[model samples]
Target: MKTTNYDIIIIGGGMVGASLACALADSTLKIAVIEGREPPAEWPADSFDIRVSAITRASENLFRHLGAWEEMQRLRVQPYQAMEVWDATGPGHIHFEAAELGEPNLGHIIENRVITRALRQRLREHHNIDYRCPAHPKGLLPLIDRAQLQLDDGSRLQAPLMVGADGAHSWLRQQAGIAVAERHYGQTAVVTTVQTEKHHQDTAWQRFLPSGPLAFLPLPGGRSSIVWSTTAEQAEHLLALDAGEFMAELGEAFAHRLGAITALGPRGAFPLKGRHAKQYVKPQLALVGDAAHTIHPLAGQGVNLGLADVEALAAVVLDAHRARRPIGALKTLRRYERARRGDNLLMLDAMGAFKSLFSNDTPGLRELRNLGLDLADHAGPVKNLIVARAMGLDALPAASLATS
Candidate 1:
């Protein structure tokens, strides 16, 4: 078969991979992207994609650096000025306002599809990047300095660095003989959008119930996007409900905080599980995003975590290339792995702790957590620290978090 060579080949064209492509666009390195799905031709400026994320200021800055944030802004991404978290069993609640941090907004809630499309557009503008859609890597062979990839088409590509941004079931990671530690939470996430009777006032709200956490993220219009996490059986039942019944049930579930839920869009459910690869990099291969680790979406930091991995990996690769060192050298890749492993583990542990803490039915534990929230709310310095952490400022001291 024929063989083409590239400086780097990324095996997933999702936001993380595409952002990595864009970040490396200005460099002379030749990048090839292998994606199973093609990007949309155009983004819907006013519509909402069922999958949305609460983008932190740090992630937003990374998007800006990649030249995709302006396009996201053009697509009418909604900036949430405040976040309110409460529990059903207690009067304890907490509110985080962006003004406390001297920022205009806490974070931006954007449709996943819009961000993906914008990243694709940026990738297209880069002459050094080559994107292959509906393609898969058949196999990978690591060489002394570069790695060779065998595509399903029987074609071959060689690169000094090979990245697996594919997902939780990363084919590249498996092919590299890397093991993963996975745990099934037995929960599923039901996501959809609703047209509420009252405006959200640019506030994102989350309510902790005995079953799971339900988040109402404000959209550009008066509508709100809902991410409800519950057990598998419960999620299936929710999905089985008719539009009218679903809206009614959802309104009741949410205690109608935004008033009556008038309209409901299509609902989709994704099984929730936690997985982290035993190793993030080998001789010439590295894993990013979901391929490395996946956390619960209860905090809405899943995508942000993936973006952070991309940022860190890209910075390491760029630095190595500038130093005239092999980008895929074990020493260089180890730097990326070491820098990200602790942060990833920290987030995974935090989400797990939060999930276990909130999922408990014990009265004492409930009271303790609720009281903790109330205490944090009443303590100004504590509240500021929590808000900063949630805003992605305190997660890691990477250069990516520095305000531009």
Candidate 2:
């Protein structure tokens, strides 16, 4: 079969994949991004996507570096100046303020569609990248020095390096014989947009219930995006409620913190699971973004972690090129894996710990966690560190020794 060759072909052109392409747009290498779906051309102001991300400042910096942040801002993004967290069943609670850190805002809450749209637009201007959207994968063939992808159109594409940014159920990773360890959290995240009786004051609020954590993220026009995690069955029940009933239950659940939820826009629920690939790379095949690791969304750091992966992978690839080494070689790919896996694993573990500690109502553990929260809140330096760590501001820790 005839094959079109390039230096790199990335599968899945979501935020992370597209960001990688943008990162290398000015480089000498030819790159191609094949996405299975096309992003929407416009996001109507009156409607909000249920799937939104709490974008860390680090991710904002990344997009700024790639020249995409300004374009995203033009579309509409809500920068939250503060965050409030409290346990619904206990006295554990704390608040984080960007003012304390001398920063304008803690982060922005943006629709996933907005991010993908901004990235797709940026991809159009990059001369080095070939954007192939609405494309489907047919098969894969791994060779000695390169990997090949069979497209649905019966055409094959070859690249010295093929990356899987295709997400949690990555076809490329499976085709490359990479294994993943997965743990289903048995919880579903129900998301929707709501209008409250009072203004949010540009603050993000999170309340921990026994079922899971629920976040009320600030948005424009005194609206908020609600991400309520709960048992799957309960999630289904919540989705089935009429708007008025849903708003009633929701307002009560949040203790009417923002006052009554007067209106609800739309609702969606997604299953929660944590997955870690057994390996991030092998030979000429590699993985990034959700293909490498997926975490619980309680902390709203999922995309931030994925973007960090993009940064590390891009740096590794460029450094390999500078050293005149094959970018897809095992040694070169391992460097990228080594630079990322530990930090990702640490975060995954932390999220799991949070879920375990907060999801239980055991008297002893409850007291322990509440005490810890109170201590962390009162301890200025420690609270700052925790906030910094969640913001992806802390230095990336060393990757595990044996894993990659």
lDDT of 2 by residue, 112-203 (tens): 88899999999999888989988878999878799888999888999999999999899998888888999788899999999999999999
Candidate 2: which pairs clash?
none
Off by over 4 Å in 1: 43-46, 395-404
Q: Please list all clashing residue pairs in model 1, or write none if there are none.
A: none
lDDT of 1 at 218: 94
Q: What lDDT is reached at residue 84 by model 2?
A: 91
- Give the per-residue lDDT digits (tens) of candidate 1, residues 1-404: 77899999999999888988887767788999999997566645455688998999888888887879899898768999999999888887999888877999999999888898899888888989999888988877777789999999998999988999998889998898999988677689999988898899899999998888999999987889999999999999999989888898888888889898965467999999999899999988899999999989998888888988887888888888878999988999999999889989888988988888887879999899999989989999988987887788875533642321
What TM-score, over all chains together, does every model reach? 0.96, 0.96
Model 2 misses residue 126 by how many Å? 0.9
Poorly placed runs, candidate 2 (over 4 Å): 396-404
Give model 1 RMSD, 1 decimal: 1.9
Candidate 2, residue 253: lDDT: 86
